[model samples]
Target chain A: MTSPEERLQAAQQVLASWAGDTQSPEPNRLDVGVAAQNLIAAIEALIGARWGYLSAITGLDLGVEAGQIEVLYHFCEGAAVLTLRVATPRASASVPSVCPLIPSASVFERELVEMMGIQVVGTPDNSRLFLADDWPDDVYPLRKDAVLERGVKEQGNE
Target chain B: MSEAVVQDKKRFVVPIGPQHPALKEPGHFEFTVDGEIVTGATVRLGYAHRGIEKAVESRNWTQSLYLLERICGICSHVHAMTYCLGVEKLAGAEVPPRAQAIRVLVAELERVHSHLLWLGVAAHEAGFDTLFMYSWRDRETVMDLLESFTGNRVNYSANILGGVKCDVTPDLASAILKGVDFLEERSRHYLNVVTTDEVFLQRTRGVGTMSKEVAERLGVVGPTARASGVARDIRIEAPYAAYADFPVQIVLAEAGDLEARFVVRIKELFESYRLIHEVIDKLPPGELQTRMPRKIKAGETISRVEAPRGEAFYFIKSNGSDNPERIKVRTPTLCNMGSVVATAVGHQLADMPMILAGIDPCFSCNDRTVAVRDAAGALVTWESLRQRRLAHQENK
Candidate 1:
């Protein structure tokens, strides 16, 4: 029954313990930067307080130059969107699977593992969701510096 | 996990393909059975993965719009409109109210057509071809209206960067009203059949029931979650486009079974019919297009739109450039797909296909990809795309 603003304020209060740097990108959106270690605790807090449902998990590569891969876990309550931003080193990109907290997160984590080449420790299944089985490992196509071959060849063209 | 007698080390698995006619998409599902009762189930999708998310990172603001539109054949307008709304939100461009109304109008029409298509498919899966045939035949009414109104039927391309492309003319408005009227009556009959038909009810009732607790824990979305009585509709909870101006009530069912899924979707059709009429009758009067900058400012924006199946979420990040830094699309099918695996357990193995269809799962929606031929798929210039299309046509 609370308004979106009230809900968002409540989220800010919930995550106040773990959020490192909080920013309001939009009027209804709250962006909280959390260390990779604190990501789980912050998420547990949100769900524990019944803040909102996890809307999506977005993986971002800050380009080859930045040497950082960022994962955004977005939770939505009404029109309010609260994002938990976690950045990891590109070479050993890893995020503790929130699947332990949110089982549905396994799907998003699987896609992230293959697409962005992030290591999601403790995910139920690390199998490919989009990439082919014989596809080369460690070549994350979504990475800014991924070396993608020409368009997929037709079955006979090979 | 079931009360049914468990056989020692029994793992008789039934695999429904990455290509099977029963479940019409390129998804592989495995169900472990013990004496006709499913013990455990797992689904593997993405056979048709198109690499579109990776492709969007390379394409500039506008080209990505058309690519995102094709994310789902059934809910293409929602994809396009959601992209437009995200891009506009980042660019700080204001879409005209009239254009927003048209966007909602087209979105509601898409919802009606999508629900009808699901009804037919679910009916077919349940071996109720009579209802299937009738529903598919009646679905053409909305299809024809969409084709006439938006030009193409499935991927209508009805949305532009700042606003929508199509407008509701007086002629089109009258035609749409007439079309919805016919659909309203047909939808009522189908609803009655799905709710009351005894034979069909046998397949759907008390089958694959998902309680509200299970629905929330698994994070199922759209009609599937609503059927479980989870009040999680993006349209009502977080109104976007013109949904704010014209609102629709949330549809819910307590049973949380295949029948409830049927009831929830059919009831939604009536809600859509009302929204369509509301948008057309109160068609805002103003310009349809707004100016957008070539290079969008650096920012992060999340746009959540309620697609036919569920909530379609988009996360767009721009590094103050023409091309997006990162674009992530989390379709509703992915959210509800988990529920199928969780609920499929303990049900009769024969009911697997019907339970799968209850969520109206779209594999291609979850498997979005781009046909990249170069370093970054973003180098696909419009001219090259046109040349490729021309070559493809000549080859055909």
Candidate 2:
């Protein structure tokens, strides 16, 4: 029932303590940049206040040139959507798990782990969620330059 | 199959499928059971994961629209519609009011067919074949209307990037009105049958009753959340497409059981029928196609639409080029899948099929036949298997 602007303002206040830089790319959306250390605090703030449901988690590869991956946690309330953005260096891309707070988030976290090769620290399940068993380790399928197949040794009825 | 996944050697865990667990879809579930009662459960999906999100990155704007529509066979229009709305937002393109209304019309038609299909499937799961047969038989009216109107039965490619591709002629409008009139009467009859049928009620009444708190915590969407009083329909709350022009009343049920899910979805059928008639009567006059840029501006946008299942969420990012930089799709089934695992913990194994059908899980939207293997793990040939079955039939 509340307006999208009003909901984003409320979310902005709740996440103010941890947000570094904030931007509104569209009218109904708010993007907040949060440090990796403060990620849980920001998520807890939104969920604690019942701001919205955790909609989806998007893993964006800035590219091989940028050597950084940005993890966006999107939360939607009616018409409003608030995203908590965290950028990690590609070499050491890791974010603390939010599954301790929201159990349903394990699916999203698993996706980030398998697709972007990001280390989701302390997630409840660390197994492969989508990739095949024979899929080589350290090969993330969603990376910008990810090869479809390479280094697959044939097993001749071993 | 192993103690590692279950984490206890003494425990007896029953793995339902990487095959048909209940519905003919491909999802694997492990239900930890003691006697007839289940204690805990886990589900493994992606048996048919097509990886559309990754595939779209290599495609241009126009090409991806067709590819995204293949995400689900049933609710194809919503995917194309969601992508177009996000792309239009990024390009700053304006679609005509008539085009928007047509989009809603096709969307509502798609919803009608989806709900009726779910009704038949749910009935079949409950071992009520008469309802299954009757509902699917009546579903042909909407299916026929869709085929005649949109030119396809399943993937009605009715949407282009800027606007819609189909137009409703006078004859098409009359046909739709007549078709939906029949469907409305059939739907009313179904509502009575589901509410009053004592045998059907026993299978659905109190099974998998999730409280409002659990529903929220699990974060179910669409009819599943609405059945538990979540009040989170994107059509009403956000009003994408022409939903603003023609308002949608959010249907709600507080029981949160399998029966509540049935009732909520059936009630939503009536809402779709009403919207179809409204859009046809107040059909705006304008262009169906709007000019749009091949290269969208550099911006990131989120588009959400209320699909028949729930909120079909698409996040689109353009890099000032023809192709997209990144696109993420989170289907409603992905959001509501967790609830099935959580709710299956305390029910009898016999009730598993109905409880699983309660969510109307669409695993990858692909259909296939079962692969039967013998005791020694050798695959059974279809011809030999068929002949053996025929011989046994004659012997019995």
Tell me the spans in candidate 2 whose CA falls farther than 4 Å from its real position: A150-158, B1-8, B365-396
Candidate 1 residue-wise lDDT, B179-280, digit = tens: 899989998999899999999999999999999999999999999999999998888988899888999899999999999999999999999999998998
Candidate 2: global Cα-lDDT?
Answer: 0.88
lDDT of candidate 2 over A1-158, digit per residue (tens):
68999999999999989988899988899999999999998888888898999989999999999999999999999999999999999888999999999999888888789889999999998776666566678888788978755321211111
Clashing pairs in 2: B17-B28
What is the TM-score (0 to 1) of candidate 1? Answer: 0.94
The docking category that best describes candidate 2 is acceptable
Chain B of candidate 1 achieves a TM-score of: 0.93
Q: List the DockQ of the predictions in order.
A: 0.53, 0.44
